[model samples]
Target: MQDVKADVYVPGHGPILKGASALDRHIKFYKDLRNIIKDAINDNIEATKISVPDTFGEPDEGRKNMTVETWLKFYG
Candidate 1:
């Protein structure tokens, strides 16, 4: 992070962030993803249920949201 004067950087799992704030972003991402998937499944959006899950991994409520197994079930 000290390599340059960059104010914000996007980590692997979170949005563009500065230091510790990235952790929170990642958590929110998972929670939101979980809700999105659950909504899609309930709505019977068959296409999205397959494709979105592929791109977005598993749904994690509090860090255990998404898993590889979850993704494989649809878009694997």
Candidate 2:
């Protein structure tokens, strides 16, 4: 994404994101999420018990729980 320069990004869901900073924020969000999940796994936290932090910027309760469940299936 950093290699591809664009004025705007059209995601499959959500509103259109504008500017390169949007990409940066997107990348950071994923990185932070990955780190959080990895840390949870290391701490022996149960997937069903894990909670998404507010800093993740994901507001949808269903989506947040689904994301953690999906990642747990893959990385837990």
Candidate 3:
């Protein structure tokens, strides 16, 4: 979107966003998630033990509803 210089962004869920500033939170969320997963892998933590933090913000309902076990099976 930013590469394309789109004026508006539509996510898979939730309300539409406008402009670069609107993407800040989402960009941070992805960056944080990447860091979390990397650290967990480095620590040899089981995927089943990993949980998304509340500080990561409200996940989509589908993701919010997914269990840790489900995530493990999906990612592992």
lDDT of 2 by residue, 1-76 (tens): 6787899988777667798988777777778778889989999898767776665364687887898988877877
Ranking by TM-score: 2, 3, 1
- For model 3, residues 1-76, the per-residue Cα lDDT tens digits are 6676777899888668787777776677656666666677668787655656565465666675464445444445
lDDT of 2: 0.78
Q: Provide the TM-score for each candidate, comma-separated.
A: 0.41, 0.76, 0.54
Local distance difference test, candidate 3: 0.65
Model 3 pairs in collision: none
Off by over 4 Å in 3: 1-7, 11-15, 53-76
TM-score of 2: 0.76
The lDDT per prediction is 0.51, 0.78, 0.65
By summed lDDT, the worst window of 10 consecutive residues in model 3 runs over 67-76
Could you tell me how far off, in angstroms, the CA of residue 70 lies in candidate 1 after the best superposition? 4.5
Identify the runs in model 1 with alpha carbons over 4 angstroms from their true place.
Answer: 1-18, 49-76
lDDT for model 1, on a 0 to 1 scale?
A: 0.51
Candidate with maximal TM-score: 2
Tens-place lDDT digits, model 1, residues 1-76: 4354555776665556765555455656556656665665666655333323333464454433334237435532
Q: What's the residue-level lDDT of 7 in candidate 3? A: 79
